[model samples]
Target: MDKLEGKLHKLEFYISLLLQMVDDTKYPFFKLVIENQLSEEEVTEVIELCKQTEIDFYVQKEQGWVIYEDLLAQFVGQLNSKLPVNQVIKSLYDQEMYSELMGEFLSIIAKHN
Candidate 1:
């Protein structure tokens, strides 16, 4: 496959993996996949490609909660597939901004059916 084709194939595969992860009961294994398989550049591309339609779904329900919006942006900002999401969660917690709600949002995105 060509470069773009290769990228698209990987993207589709990862997206499917993410969907499967939502229903997966194993947190540790899910974290491993997120850390190892999901690349920042690739996820970034996915975000950019989906941003228009994605609409930060969680934010809309709250009539656009500013904090959630900021958190969402930050989380997406650091989408290095090599990095585990816990790192971002830790940073947010250290900054006194992390919340279950934020985690829920990320979970929703990752596992949104």
Candidate 2:
């Protein structure tokens, strides 16, 4: 089933991300991701998948990456069902940093399940 495969792919993508940096020594595990030594301990398999793109981009470009505009738009549309996610997403949108490394995340999901 396409849906099942898609979900699996998503899980795989997140896993790849978590296997990277699993520890940050700055933030106290309750603050923004920026205030610390980048790590992945706090990230979950699901959330990690969403951040795969960012991880890859940082390695390849040494710069931040953004998800495709169309994809980001679609994600936002889907986020409407969750008010809390929508709020955070909106904040990122306002900052023009909405992609937040999601492109690599999608790419990883498309790779292997």
Candidate 3:
């Protein structure tokens, strides 16, 4: 479970980095949600769920960010698909913009949850 938790923590760290580029007002809320989500058992449960579902959860393994499943990933892909070519390029190349986008996505998830 140590390896799994390590991976989970890595994922969280990337998320925190992404959130950093978003509205400062959202940070505390985001931090709360992330902290709540990061318990050891929770990480293990998440990994088990991913395994049972056979989802390619990791989007960028080197960066330790996971998109969970293709359906969810496709949704994000769709969001990116609508962007102007230049904006898309910027989103790809600009960490802050990418973080802002991910933060917006996380905020939406937090709202519905």
Candidate 4:
């Protein structure tokens, strides 16, 4: 495949992984959140992170898709350093903006598929 095709393939793989993580409840963090095992402070922090992520996404989106993806990856990396992967995913899944983010990703996949 050519460069653009290769990039799209990589992005598609990443998106699919993200979708799976969001849907799967097997992770300990998912179970903990569901069982109300997290402290109120922990829940508040996750929610704050999710809101910040959403805002950052929209800001980067205006710059263009490539920049958006780059910044998003960096932002998620930062989040991963502070939170478990499953917690980050769960927090993002709970956001009102999650569907909109997924819709954008799905449309991109549809175009390439």
TM-score leader: 4
Q: Give me the displacement of residue 103 in model 4, in angstroms.
A: 6.3
Stretches of candidate 1 off by over 4 Å are 1-23, 28-66, 82-113
Residue 9, candidate 4: C-alpha displacement in angstroms: 50
Question: Model 1 over residues 3-112: C-alpha lDDT tens digits?
Answer: 99999999989877876666433343334446456666665553453343234544554684444444556556655545555554443333333245445555555654
**Least lDDT summed over 10 consecutive residues: which range in candidate 2?**
25-34
* Residue-by-residue lDDT tens digits, candidate 4, 36-105: 4456677666557656766777776776654344544544565534355544454444443355553444
In model 3, state the lDDT of residue 74: 47
Of 1 and 2, which scores higher on TM-score? 1
Candidate 1 lDDT for residue 103: 53
Q: Whole-model lDDT, candidate 4?
A: 0.54
Off by over 4 Å in 2: 1-46, 53-67, 77-80, 84-86, 90-113
Q: How are the candidates ranked when ordered by TM-score, highest leading?
A: 4, 1, 2, 3
Per-residue CA lDDT of model 2 for 1-113, tens digit only, reads: 99999999998687657645544332223223333223454334324434553454555555543435444444445432323443334333333342544433335445544
- Candidate number that wins on TM-score, 1 or 4: 4
RMSD of each: 12.2, 16.2, 15.2, 16.6
Per-residue lDDT of model 3, residues 1-113, tens digit only: 99999999998799878766765443433343353445655445433542433333233433576443343354444432223323322332243423443443444455556
lDDT score, candidate 2, position 2: 100
Tell me, by lDDT, which candidate is best. Answer: 4
Which residue runs does candidate 4 get wrong by more than 4 Å?
1-36, 67-69, 78-97, 102-113
